[model samples]
Target: MNERNHISIREAIRGRITDGEWAPGAMMPGETDLAEEYGCSRTTVNRALQKLAEDGLIERKRRAGTRVREIPSRQAKFRIPILRHEIEAAGGAYSSRVAFRETLKAPGFIQSRLRLATGARVLRLHTVHLSDGQPYAFEDRWVNIKAAPGVVDAPFDIISANEWLVREVPYSSGDVRFSAMAAGQIEAQALATSLGAPLFTVERTTWLRDLYITTTKLCYRPGYHMRTEL
Candidate 1:
């Protein structure tokens, strides 16, 4: 019925899985049947099951139907954070500055990453996130204008590109990678740290179905740690 009801259906299904009502290797009920049982539409049931499958709690095969995962390789799905929320959660004043925003031809590396053709145009943004007026992280992001055309007119000065994209884009899939890299002169200057200081770097790429949305690299000053619970 309502969006809340839609989410409740998902939660209820997850409860059944976690409570062992749906054990590993067990076939889940048909979507029509679950829709009847939950008093929701088949679409709602399908959405819930899709999320479970994405989380590795279930498997869906054409012609066979859905089943609980035999050996679940579930990974924690971290909710991507708005910098304001992240800073407030840490009890720090949150602020952001847009250092650069421009349009340019997509580089070969980005084209390869997003599977775009050579010479495709993209919107590029460089931003710095601050906590308590201290440098916290630097964001280098590229957006596919063809995928998210609204980004061309977005005001990154008022809100971060990360926040805007998360709120506006309907991304279906993404991947994130984390590593440590030695800060170069530009990074060191932006982060106010010594050259060659270790910085925590996060690279993320997101897509909406087949449409690639964005690729972003967030490099944090020393002492940055990301946590996710099982």
Candidate 2:
């Protein structure tokens, strides 16, 4: 069978749970019934059901049967790279400029976002993310040293903050809020564009286990967009 069969069966089970077709604590139809309905096989239904249970969307018992759980929609996220890595992958030159790094004493925004105790120190990194010889993104980030002290020593010459952090640091919390904002004179200058331009902004905050790690503001140039399917 094609790969889509697995996805079809998986989505079918989830659709029942979401539509309340399978009520919480109520047992689902047996594998035989599902196989007959989808015209697949008992094995296909079993594989799909096993994956659903592993994802915490259902519970299965030896004799009691499979039942829906009380969990909400399970979401899986990914860390998308800032720049196209084809250049780096094809042995072409990839470079980044770290314009500056400084310590900020808990600005009002980060103070509340990071849920700090006040007067906490954060590292501000201003960087121009680049690929080959072109600008990719403008990153203004604040890192909480309490969670990642080594981040201060981590290098950013050949890779981006997004790439390096995902490999080295393990964060527990991630919140992303997106908006369209007008670019100011400074943004236009760094991105090599005109003033008062439209930019897509992504505000991301992450917590490393229990300690706060970093908050970043990413600005994408004109004609930039991101898409995902539900």
Candidate 3:
């Protein structure tokens, strides 16, 4: 019904588990029953359970139903960094430009990565983030139009797609990778670095439930460092 309703149901269920009313390994009531008990819609109950699952408080199985985890899972959560905020936090002015934008049939590699149909069309963008007017990172991104149709008309020039997606899209699951790679021609040019120079890189793919949303690779300027807290 509303945000508060969803949160209340989640907390109610969480309290049951925490207070030993629903012991560890106990099967949780189905969404239909929970909805009736809470006097809310089944969709609201589902959302609450989904959040609990994400938080590692419960486990959900296709046909086995939901249950409180015997031993709650411990997961390392990483927040997607906003490039502009990152630069500003470091006491540098932030700016960005979209170097390229196009919509075309996904390439073979892109199709495989996103698990798209052979002829699926995607909106592709190349952007360079600048700090103090110097190149800081180069981003190459592909958005699945079917999953995020709003991106078709979004203005990447005004606000980078990275920030836009983070605000507008809510992902259920995602994968991220960090590595070092020699700069390619496009990445080198965009980052204003020498070709073949070693660069810090990040690749991420996001999905909303079963639907693929976007995938992107960010190549950072040389000497860049990344830190995260567990």
Question: What lDDT does the true structure give each of the candidates?
Answer: 0.88, 0.77, 0.90
Q: Rank the candidates by lDDT, best first.
A: 3, 1, 2
Which residue pairs does candidate 1 place in steric collision? none
Question: Weakest 10 consecutive residues, lDDT, candidate 2?
Answer: 78-87
Using TM-score, rank the candidates from best to worst. Answer: 2, 1, 3
Of the two candidates 1 and 3, the one with more favorable lDDT, higher being better, is: 3
Model 3, global lDDT: 0.90
Deviation in angstroms for 197 in model 1?
A: 1.0
Q: Which ten residues in a row are the worst by lDDT in model 3? A: 73-82
**Cα lDDT of model 2 by residue, 1-230, tens digit:** 54678679889888988789998778898888988998987878888888888777898898888889866446455445445473465454666788778876879988888878788888888887656667666778888877667777777665666677777675457888888878787678778877878899888898866677788988877777776443
Residue 55 C-alpha lDDT in model 2: 72
Give Cα distance to truth, residue 185, candidate 2, Å. 2.3
lDDT of 1 by residue, 1-230 (tens): 56787689988998999899999999999999999999989888888888888888999999899999988877876777877899889999999888888999999999988878788889989888999999999988999989888899998888888878888885558989989999988788889999999999999999988888899999999989888875
Q: Name the top TM-score candidate.
A: 2
lDDT of 3 by residue, 1-230 (tens): 58999999899999999999989999988888999999999999999998899888999999999999999986667656689988999999999999998999999999988899999999999999999999999999999998888998998878889888887785447899999999999988998889999999999999877788899999999999887643
Better of 2 and 3 by TM-score: 2
Q: Per-prediction TM-score, please?
A: 0.68, 0.68, 0.66
- Total colliding residue pairs, candidate 3: 0
